[model samples]
Target: MNRKQIAVVTGAHSGLGKEFVKLLTEDGTISEIWAIARNKEKLDQLISEFGNRVRVFSLDLSDRTSFSVIEKLFLEERIHITYLINNAGFAKFCSYDDITVDESLNMIDLNVSAVVALGLICIPYMKKGSHIINIASQASFFPLPYQNIYSSTKAFVSNYTRALNVELKNKGITAIAVCPGWMKTGLFDRGTIGADRATNNFSGMVTPDVVAAKALSDAKKGKDISIYGLPVKLTWLFSKVTPPKLMMRIWLMQQGIKP
Candidate 1:
């Protein structure tokens, strides 16, 4: 029996993840796409929209136990994993004092831990030409004041994915860190609760579709990082030349936050 060529995407129910799923389904090389998210209803809806090509896995990536569940399936199905998109993450727009410790930790768990865990579990099933695209943010470029924990988590993701790509080169596997600007997704709905000044400025926000398209193109080119939009690209360049303290100060001022 031949192993199926499948793509595994976390947070695949909607937003950027959903766009990725839609693109993957059209990929002639991909036999199936495993859509993983916390919402079963939304996952089921994906199957309806994309047909049997989309496999639903309603698992919360933040929970460590979820890795075990995914691992078990990998063992049983013996699928050839072509792509792993670690896109399941959240952000909160508020001061550090306003965020509970649990919220901060959960952000770490889902954004950082989930990416690491999924990479370890899926790498064995992947071969050359396989891609791992982790959705980071332009926020990763700086230490945000009000969006503190979220920025920190994305920074870890951006750096970690780049380093991981370096390590995976021996196997010809490509890892891409997608750093896009503000996206008008469901993320903002939860992120803006008791929103502070940071939420006021959503500059150069793009839709998930644009980000997803560029990510796929960059992955094919074997680029280590995919940054969509000219504004976001400029931000990445700006962060590199500027000092960390200065960058933080700039960000705080841009958001009208008091440092």
Candidate 2:
């Protein structure tokens, strides 16, 4: 007997994760979607809105056992994986030491570790035409002073996803990194300096839905880098030649932090 097809998306409750869920639910080929998030109430809402095809898994991506839960589910159903969106992550503002050790560690665990784990676990279940979309950020192109851990982790994600795309090409699996700019999500406040830097001089801002739409489309096209909006695309290009010292100072000023 053949197993059902499913899409596994972490951070499925809000932001880009939620948008991806909404988009994937429109895909007729996928039989089910294992939506993972810690907030059960939001997950409930997602299921209610998206319908029965969504299987809610209330698991925190920061936990070591989260991946284990998915593995066990795979054993039971032996599902064919279609889309794996590693989108659960967080960012805390301020200098390195000023931020709590636990906060920084949490950022690393969720953004970097969980992405690595989920991609590894789901890739084996995926074959030709499968897509893996990793939500990196425009910050991944350069170091962000006030968001050090978050940006660095995204850097790791960007590099890893690009490399994975190359390695998985022969297998017909497509893996791509999405580096988007300031998205109008609850995670960011328009009044804050952290938010200002994300908007910057280039592209103003975008909604999570827009980012998800472009990223999913790009993943389907087999693009290694998925950058939403021309401003972000230009930022990624400029980052290649921008001097590190100057970039750091510019970021500091934008965040209202003294360099």
Candidate 3:
């Protein structure tokens, strides 16, 4: 039996996740797109917009049980996932002292844990030419001051995706970490609260569509990490040469905060 080609995208209700869904819908090879998100209303909206081509799963990835639910569905349906986009994550722009313990752990649960879980659950269903796109951030490059937890989580994503790509090459599976600079997304709306001073300067911000397009292009080329925009690429290069301490200081300076 020919398996139905599907694309699974978490955080598909909005922002980069939605953009990924949009692009995947355009791909002729994909038979269906699985849109996973927390908002039932928004997911329903996506169904209305994209019609039957898109299927929405209203599940919060941060909750560990959601992984089991996804795995069960995959087993029952026996579907082939062509593109697995792990894009459900959030950030808080505050000092360690300001953020509650629950918030810090939630960030890790969604950003780091969800990425790993989804990859494991979906990999068995993926065949050759399958692409796994993890939405990492340019913040992964350095030790950010106020955005400490978020940056660290993204750093883990970047490293994990690269290493996973190397391991999955024999299986003809590609994992690409998209490290885009500040993008026009809902992340800022939640992250910028309570830290207005530190979040004021958003340099080299671009739209989610731009990053989504570049990520797909890079994935086609089988690149390990897909970085959008020249400014972000340049920053990635700079991060390699600069010391960690210095990079932290520079990030603080850029945000108009004292080191």
Candidate 1 lDDT over residue span 104-128, tens digit each: 8999999999999999999999999
Using Cα atoms with residue i matched to residue i, what is each candidate's TM-score against the true structure? 0.97, 0.93, 0.98
> How many residue-pair clashes does candidate 1 contain?
0
**TM match of model 1 to true structure:** 0.97
Give the candidates in order of TM-score, highest first: 3, 1, 2
lDDT of candidate 2 over 1-259, digit per residue (tens): 9878899998899888999999999999999988899989999999899999999999988988878988888888868899999988887655566556887788899999999999888988998999999999998989887677778999999999999999999999999999999887755642124432332332378889989999999998999999988888887888889997888887767655565
Q: lDDT-based ranking, best first?
A: 1, 3, 2
Which pairs clash inside model 1?
none
- Per-residue alpha-carbon lDDT of model 3 for 1-259, expressed as tens digits? 8888999999999999988888888899999999999999999988887778999889999999998899888888858989999999999888887878998999999999999999999999998899999989999999888888999999999999999999999999999999999899999898877764455678788999999999999998999999888999999999999999998877777778876
All candidates' lDDT scores? 0.92, 0.85, 0.91
Of candidate 2, the 10-residue stretch with the lowest lDDT total is: 190-199
Clashes of 3: 0
TM-score-best of 1 and 2: 1
The numbered model that scores best in lDDT is 1
Error of 3 at 103 (Å): 0.8
lDDT of 2 at 3: 75
Model 3 root mean square deviation, Cα atoms:
1.0
In model 1, which regions exceed 4 Å deviation? none
